[model samples]
Target: MKTYRDYDDLPKIELPYGKEVSISDSTLRDGAQMPGIVMRSKHKVQIYEYLHMIGIEKLETFVYNERDRKAIKLMQDKGYEFPEITGWARANPADIDMVLNVDGIEETGILMSVSDPHIYDKMKLPTREAAQEKYLNALQYAVDHGLRTRAHIEDMTRADNYDFVFPLVEKILEIDPDCTIRICDTIGYGIPFMNVDEPYGIPTIVKYLKNELGAKNIETHCHDDFGLAVANSLAGYWHGANWSNVTYLGIGERAGNAEMEKLLVFLKRRIKGFEKYDLSCLVEFAKFMEKEIGIRIPRNKSVVGQNVFAHESGIHTAGVIKNPFTYEPYPPEIVGGQRNFLIGDSSGIEVLKFKVQETLKEMMDVHIEVDKNDKRLRNIQADIQRLFNEDERVSCISDEEIRAYVKKYFMFNPIVDQELHRREDDESPDNTI
Candidate 1:
């Protein structure tokens, strides 16, 4: 059968042996950062457990700051089920100390500004070398404490100094070969579509880092400024990224982080052999998050979008009714969604008949076959179609109304037709044939 393995010839890299790519969720931290929303420690633990249940490999549970120390301590004491619980921090020992003090955070990530803009304009650093020292010092502190560190290269997309960025990554790698380094698009300013001249596209960056820094330890962290976070994250996975970072629903600063849903859909459905992920709990987690965070998922967003499984077009609805693959990328039920028929102007006669029949069958507990050519059904359908065309308020027509129309025009009540027959009697002709 066709599977992700069939695309072996394409530029693909394995996520790992058990799975091809690692699924990471940052909802607890980045997702909580959505404006005016707060998930208490109890809710935090709940989300953490849900993500772990869904088989997300890494959970960046919290940022190590004084303000969040109490919550982090609670989670640590609870002993969340995730194998890897990572702490986010600035590229400073003080920030790392906040997590190290939390009792049970084993893995750590520290981000440092890489672009010259931050160095020259923001921090007033004299030159790139001085900035490199500051970044390297912070990484060394995490290493000295025996923490498995993932150094985040910040503002990589806008950085004018790859010369500095590459050397900085090399410096951190030299200190600890086991240390993982991530290329971050800090201001949400990266693009996924490959361009020949500039090769910071996630895949290109992964390739460069792997060729120079080694693939065994390269990771990626993306933001969704231009709405390419999922694409960029996948590109990194395609090239060679063992670890990736994401937030649920891509909720973070500005546009947000990469959403775990989009990435997993591409991995589980589009890519084969990476099937070790237990996605049964995906929908539950997404719904829990939507309710907790108060953000309604967009209809056409993708993967978990409500309308992803909804069919509307006459041809598309007809084809999907026969076989979902005619229009769907995969069965909607696979992602915790059921196929839905969206009644619209583009609906065909078959759709109207099918909907009516299905409704009638359910209502009467018997099979119903609607004849599209039946005068009563045809006239009602025409009226319904015209009504929908004029007003968008109505989509579903009740079975009671349908039954009423059928009884009034198609069943034992033939008064309307009999009256018309009386009016036409003068023109009637005798027929013996």
Candidate 2:
């Protein structure tokens, strides 16, 4: 059987997107709106650098505050240019004017609500025509002021595309063909599969915009309310949308948007020539965001989470030790993640031996490696199993705790025991271990 390591060299199903696909970051805007996520200015700057370093093409940030303006200026001054900074704004001249002040932001997203709730209730516009008029005036104002516009169609999944959405897009295009449109599935109501109804099914919506409207530049701003953010974004790309909007760690309002890290990893696999992208900073970037905002990432979350590459099951660990592709889709190191053999309940005897090898290497001054076939290793594995299977409360065992067993059982051998004991007597923290 062909292994995952051999996947790049084999024939695969190519997606329908024309060669190059673009990605945009929305962490500075929508990500900030998530409850309890207040990203500091310095951390925002760091995130921008990380995203640009990983080859993301654009950043959609809020030009709504002083701190956001400051962070944009800082990134501009540093000269990291891959992610062209675009400011988000409401459909008004005053908000677009605020965008003009942010040093390097050339594009802005003007909010255009097409759904019934926003049209009549939230925005309080009497009619859909009036709402379209307001957005068109705002678009013209942005054009007149030397700025590109992205008319963000908010709540589009719940809107009437035939009567309202397309007309508004047509109006925006009439002024400037260069202006792009972002399809915002604001409430995460978009279903990403095919053959569903208009505004509900992802393929139909993308097909309409790409084929019917003949949209010049299209973008996907998806949400994970139904856990299909990435799926919908992929469907958009497959049909012909050029750009996808994402955030670090998928952090945003309620269920959040498509995760930038997940999207990159997905792209790197399907598209050829994407291998040169520098993804070394992605894992650390996720850690930084989690640390800064106190948002906890579920350990099993793909791409940047802690347990994506961690293994402890007996059969799986044995196979992975031989070749990681036996258990993993690809090497964890592809996204700057490391493979680890966790010692716990369900660990194979080989895993115990591997942990012992690691412990002896790290904590000792001498070379004393554990052989897999040694009787001591079997004994140690038996004892470790007893620690878990015998005790009802014990869920998992740590490497440190396993090392405690190794020390007690095998380290008292005649030759190396003398040096280890002498070091232990010295009472240094390293020796204490």
Candidate 3:
């Protein structure tokens, strides 16, 4: 049985035993920040249901306005135990109050811009120390108001982990021991390889947070500027982080956040204790995002794309028809997708035979097996090839088109054949006498 392998030569890091690894979704908050995305109250509610149905542990949302509050209330009405709805707010008293005003939200992510560029340039703070003090005060206020805090160290990959990031996180832990420290790679500059230096090394950052700071709960919040969001997030989990912050379809600012569907599939395949997740709804969720919410999901996107399980080439379709595992990594049904053997210019006799048999069985309640070398099957294949070759068709032949070809070539109707055979038997010489 060939399976995925983890060799000893690789830079290996094990998650600490007894720690719980879970996913926190930000599709409602960060994902909505994607330009041109308008997640109205109803959209938020539907997305929430899909996330919950797929087994996300937490979902963070913005609580700045009446619409946000109403959406939160609507999601909360369902009373799901997992995917505990949380709030995202800046490190200010006003933002904290907005979170507190919500009825069921008990925990909220407090934004702390840890990178020097964010502090000195974006925020125009006097110094890093001033920013640290302000952030600590906000965290203290949120804790004082009886709300659990998740200190989001925004842009941690570009910050001085020792001088600013570490010390600030240490102080945050001191304030709220149970607080989850979300290490944000806001610019997607994080590298997954081990032995890399800080501010870019995700494994190093997560290790220090878990081993050095004694942080109980750590979350990895990554972006995809350099396309390292998923890799960096996995690195955080491999080193010791317990939570991975994600958005559905990886929809967010810039290149977007780590895709929840991709991460879930990876975790289920590589790690233990992830067998509880029901991923069958992944494709449906992607369709909803594309059709209802107006998000454009690439057709080749992993796990939940239309082309993920579609086979088109001659050799590929033949192999899939013989054994699906030959061409597919996993069963399409696992992700709520069906196998599609597409007939294009590259399709071969084997695929045509399979299609002909299937079409016959479906259209006429007759099961007629045709060999790959059968003349009727060959004629149908040639006609399909002519459409692409002579007619210059560029698209795969649709099933309906294939059924028409089956009707044209295989003209033997089972009912008519049975009637003709009965007449022949009745007209035999012994019966006539």
Best prediction by lDDT? 3
lDDT of each: 0.72, 0.83, 0.88
* Residue pairs clashing, model 3: none
Lowest summed lDDT window (length 10), candidate 1 = 2-11
TM-score of each: 0.83, 0.91, 0.91
TM-score of candidate 1 against the unseen true structure: 0.83
Instruction: Work out how many backbone clashes candidate 2 has.
Output: 0
Clashing pairs in 1: 4-272, 15-20, 15-21
Residue-wise C-alpha lDDT for candidate 1, range 1-433, written one tens digit per residue:
5343222334434453333557666787777887867777777777767676667777776664544666666656656566367788877789888768766677787877888788899889899888888888988888888788888777887775356777777788888788777778777666665552232566667777788666467767788877778777877776677777888778877788888877877777666566766666666666877787677878787777778888777898887877666688766766777777765667776666666666667656789676779676677678768777789545565556656655555553458777777767746675221
Ranking by lDDT: 3, 2, 1
Better of 1 and 3 by TM-score: 3
Candidate 3 weakest lDDT stretch, 10 residues: 4-13
For model 3, residues 1-433, the per-residue Cα lDDT tens digits are 5453222222323355646689999999999999987888999999989888888889999998889999998998988897899999998999999999888889999999988889989999999999999999999999999999999999999999988789989999999999999999999999999999898999999999989999999999999999999998888888889999999999999899998888888777656555778889899989899988898877899999889999888899888888776777778877898888778888888887888899989987889888888777877777777777787797889999988887777765546766887898799977552
lDDT of 3 at 228: 90
* Model 2 lDDT per residue over 325-402, tens place: 778876777788899888778788877777787787777856676678887788788877777777853666777787
